[model samples]
Target: MSSSITTILTKKSYPPIGHYSQAFRANGHIWVSGQIAADADGNLLKRSMSEQAHQICKNTSKILQAAGSSLEKTVKVTVFATDFSKLPEFNSVYNTYFPQKPPRSAAEVSRLPLDVEVMMEVVALVDPGDEAKL
Candidate 1:
């Protein structure tokens, strides 16, 4: 048996503080592992659910951009929050990043790392030729 998989990996901006990858690319798609509101140094960026969600989006964007892609190319997203109550606040911030709205789902988790309130992950198919923006 043989495999021709090209495992694209990046560890510069984000390291596995937990058990995850900041981002990886292969084939024609880039799979961005879950990103929290943590800095490159793996420190949680303190902010409200609104601010935290924004930071999470911003962080994800950076990882995508590093891989020659952007959120506009994202086809799917999943958000996990400690409570459904924070979702309202998260939405206010989420809309700021995704105005056009792509495929998405939200989950209420028992807890998140550092009790950070909210976290998110995304899947994106990128085309450097595409001019569409989100």
Candidate 2:
């Protein structure tokens, strides 16, 4: 398989805050960056952990869609949180989005961009011929 890389972008999702693409496609996989609880307009949401988790999931879904993939195709996910105590809260909201229970890892971080409560990154399979949709 070719190792050529293609950066993924979409107006439906928030633009990268720094020097990173929202996602990248290569070797039949889509690697999504850690998505914060921000809207398409780049407004950060500082609500409860559950709310932030929901927004993070939404942002991830949008990026995956633009990459010609979906949450259902996700193979792995990594979640970063400011507080590990709120993991249950995060999981409650996360389960609604990833019912298939893909492989996941969660870690407590000292901080996140925008001081958001949660951020999530995912690696998902991109079906053969799916790149044509982008």
Candidate 3:
């Protein structure tokens, strides 16, 4: 059960607040960390739920690219929302990212770091040759 592990890093994505990589690659999979509505510069986007969701998804996309993957290759996704009432808004924005319907789960959390409205993370297949595109 020996597998090589690699930490994915990219300046085009937001820096991890703690001791964690934006994503990890091992055993043919890429596991991205939870992404909030923040840009690569770490500036939080404090806008409407739809906007926040869009930013979160965009952040995920960037991390996926940096990890030698893409949204189309995503196998699973988990979304954390502070307000269940805004699920529709979140879904509306999320649909634009995964129109093909990748497996996903959404949960209403008590709160998220920085008190953001939405956060998302994803798991996708790793394509080693895709690294240069990022």
Candidate 4:
């Protein structure tokens, strides 16, 4: 038996700088790639932790949308940050996107692509009817 995999992309989000889809949909789930604070053109942004978190969420949202999912459907999220002390700042913005507060794990890392302060990846359910359209 074989399954179909859909590559998700959106011009509204930061273009992938590397050879990877923004997200992939398969088996009723959308796996969004780790997103950083970058603009649509892929220029990394210099912003406060809260602002960066918001941008990352927005970028993730666009990718999810392209995959026929949304942040509200997110099941899991993993965050990597260069500073733990700014977690409060990141959470403040994160709560706005995920009011239900899906399961999440976070860790302080030494560095990330482009040295952005934070990067986030998500896994979300594919909307029932939307999957057939893929």
Candidate 5:
């Protein structure tokens, strides 16, 4: 199977620290990388679990836009949290982004990069005629 792939880049979100694009546009969808509570300068937000969740959503939103998509278009999401006890806080913030309540999964993990408490990745449908943004 052959598919055209476009790397998505944007200054609105934190720069990727690893050898991976922030997102990719292909086959009429956008695949965003796991987003954390990092700022544009790569500094961790150092905020509460809910606050960090807000930052991740904001970052993911920016990445989706850069890839010709939006949070409302998301079809699936996966969340990783180091502290399961904070799930409520994360869910509270997450609900605001996906008011449509897209299918999602959350799991407790041992740890995450940069020692951040939470991380999220998403898959969303690309808006028509917006591939140029990729």
Candidate 6:
């Protein structure tokens, strides 16, 4: 790793639900923290599983952008949800955004805050050509 590369863990991108930056950067790669189904205002969105999943995607996209990356460039993601029954609907929303289909890992947990159904973390490389944005 080059010393020029560093980690930036700031709370500006997303509010700290517990203790975490919405995303961080290191070695030219950005590792996004798990973003819940919350809006820019950090308020939990109370909606159906599908809608909540969409919001989580939106939140993740924003965080990646803030780190000089894009959803299309994401290499992998980890999705968290409480209900596997919502998989079909969640996939519908997810596929719409990630048309290229990056690598992903998903899990069905027992619960999420605000009765939310979805959350996600993403990892992407900062395009060397776009280093100015970082």
Highest lDDT scorer: 2
Give the poorly placed runs of model 1, Cα more than 4 Å off.
1-13, 128-134
Summarize candidate 1's per-residue lDDT along 34-80 as a digit string, tens digits. 77887767777777888788778888888777666788888899999
Ranking by TM-score: 4, 2, 5, 3, 6, 1
Clashing pairs in 3: none
TM-score of each: 0.82, 0.95, 0.91, 0.95, 0.93, 0.86
Whole-model lDDT, candidate 2?
0.91
Ranking by lDDT: 2, 4, 5, 3, 6, 1
Model 1: per-residue Cα lDDT at residue 39? 71
Backbone clash pairs for candidate 4 read: none
For 1-134, candidate 5 gives per-residue lDDT tens digits of 11788898899999999999999888888899999999877889988988998899999999887777899999999999898999998899889888999998989999899888999999999755566444
Shift in Å, residue 58, candidate 2: 0.7
For 5-117, candidate 2 gives per-residue lDDT tens digits of: 99999988899999999999998899999999889999988888888888989999999998889999999999998889999999999999999999999899899888887
Q: Give candidate 3's error at residue 72 in angstroms.
A: 0.3
Whole-model lDDT values for every prediction: 0.74, 0.91, 0.85, 0.90, 0.89, 0.77
> Candidate 5, which segments miss by more than 4 Å at Cα?
132-134
Tens-digit lDDT string for candidate 3 (15-133): 99888889998877889999998888999999888898888888888878777788999999998988889989989999999988989898989999988888888999876555433
Supply every candidate's count of residue pairs whose N, Cα or C atoms clash at under 3 angstroms: 0, 0, 0, 0, 0, 0
Q: Give the 10-residue window scoring lowest on summed lDDT in candidate 4.
A: 1-10
Alpha-carbon runs more than 4 Å astray in model 6: 1-13
* TM-score between model 3 and native: 0.91
Candidate 5, position 113, lDDT = 91
